[model samples]
Target: MNKSLSRLESALLLVAPLLMLLGGVLLVRYDDQGWDGVLAAMAAHPARSDVGWLLVAAGAALTVPPTAALAALVRARRPGLGATALVLTALGWASVPAYAMGGIVMEAMAHAPDRAAQVAVLEQFNDGRGNAFFLAAALGAVGYIVLAVGLARDRVAPAAAAVLIGLGGAGTLLVMAGPIRALLLVAVVLLLAGQAWTVTAGRRTAPASAVAAV
Candidate 1:
């Protein structure tokens, strides 16, 4: 039953992040069109009264399930890693509130249409109390490192399966180190790939030696 649950969880981890990535792509592709206009018009429809919010919310929602699964797996197998996952999840989830504030600020700007106020709100929404977001980034980095350690220990997934997970975490960490936001894109890609591999591979085949060790 535990193994079965792990496989299901693995599938979610792979699939959910991929969906989020796709949603992000949609937003980016449409930004020049309705997205930018919507941001500008937020003050006009402060409560997300338009369709644009749909895309953003959908994309954000995709990130949640996989993140939760990752946390669950980490908690089961590695306590320290679980704590790291929690921190990362906390930051990732915080984006919603920050974004909601951004929406409202945009709405206010629409009402008054002040460039200075718009900029201030935008900046605040981007960084305010969002140290959690940054901490999440760092924690994701830590997660990859911890996963690598687990891989080495052959505790959870097979060692062969650890590459992308490790890479995803490392990419996340790289983004946290400085102006490597580009690395974040790469990290997302790695996460999707890694999760996909795990899902398809199913549970690890515990070797005879591993069984004896356990």
Candidate 2:
């Protein structure tokens, strides 16, 4: 059962990143209209909006499993550091659903007859002033940083991977600044790739007793 569970987690970790990457690609590909434009388009084509939002939500949801798996793997190797990494990663990832779900809200707002109201809602959402927004951003940044450190210290993942994750966390500030928005995607890819490596490495190195205990 433990081995089966481990395999399941590995599969989930592998698939989740691919889904997220696909979602990111879709967002960029379809984003030619920008947020306001996309919302307007979505308003006009409800079906397309539904599909897009669904994809986004699915992608966001998939991120959680791999993140949890990463924390678990780290915990196995180093308890204290692993605990810290898990807490931070959990906090950071907790905000992903909200961020992804914003697409659904935006789609609904698009249907509003009053264009001005629609714009107002979009602006407010974009402003990022809400408590949830702050919580997600703060927790995500700090969590990734801590996770990266733990990964490096424990030698569970490559040093480069840890650096990339840390850089990605720091890069969020730059994203808010409006330049190099793509950095987020790059950071995600790095972190996911790193985690994947760790999972594979763990499977190979785990003792039979340890594997059975899990």
Candidate 3:
């Protein structure tokens, strides 16, 4: 039963990357824009824009399960792993506000067809609260880092998965400003690849003793 459960957890973890991949693809195909750009496009079409919001919501929602899988692995291994996972999970959850704000920002951008509203949105984006976006991105990068560390330490997640997560996180965090933002853009691709690998790998079983306890 523990083994079966482990496999189930692995399966759930894989979903994270796959959904990211799909979302990335949609962003590229639909708007030929980055994720934020896509959201902006969607926001531009407020009434009809709900479609894009749905996709954004879907992508954001998919981030949770894999994070949970990471937490599970941590709990199974280290004594204080649960606490660490919870802290990281809070960071993961922090992205919610960013995602929400991005949606609003996008919606505002959509209204930009009218110069006045566009100016208002631009001002809002320039304010200190605009930092929420950076926070979201930072949280995402950190979450992946924590997830990778947890997986590697627990021996449940793949080494390649860990590497990819780390790489993605690093890529995103370091070059988040200006044209370098393109590097961060590429992180999305890496994230998708890591997730796909995670999902496709063979599932493993936990120890018999652990299974009985669960």
Least accurate 10 contiguous residues by lDDT in model 1: 24-33
Between candidates 1 and 2, name the one with more favorable TM-score: 2
TM-score of 2: 0.71
Quick one: best lDDT, which candidate? Answer: 2
lDDT of 2 by residue, 1-214 (tens): 1232366766765676566555554442223225567666667766554554455456546656655655565677667766776676566655555555665666677777787766665566556564565566576677677777766765656677667656654343223212243665675576566656656554233533576799
Per-residue alpha-carbon lDDT of candidate 3 for residues 43-130, written as tens digits (9 for 90 to 100): 5456444443344345556556655655665666553654565465556545543444455555655544665555455456545675
TM-score of each: 0.59, 0.71, 0.64
Q: After superposition, how far is residue 44 of candidate 3 from its true place, in Å?
A: 7.6
Give RMSD (Å) of candidate 1 vs. truth. 6.2
Flag regions of model 3 displaced more than 4 Å. Answer: 1-16, 25-50, 93-97, 112-117, 169-185, 203-214
lDDT for each candidate structure: 0.51, 0.57, 0.52
Q: Write the per-residue lDDT of candidate 1 for residues 90-176, one digit (tens) a residue.
A: 454445434434444455555664566656554564456645555655555665666555543644455565678677645644342
Native-to-model Cα distance after best TM-score fit, residue 54 in candidate 3, in Å = 2.6
lDDT at position 190, candidate 3: 76
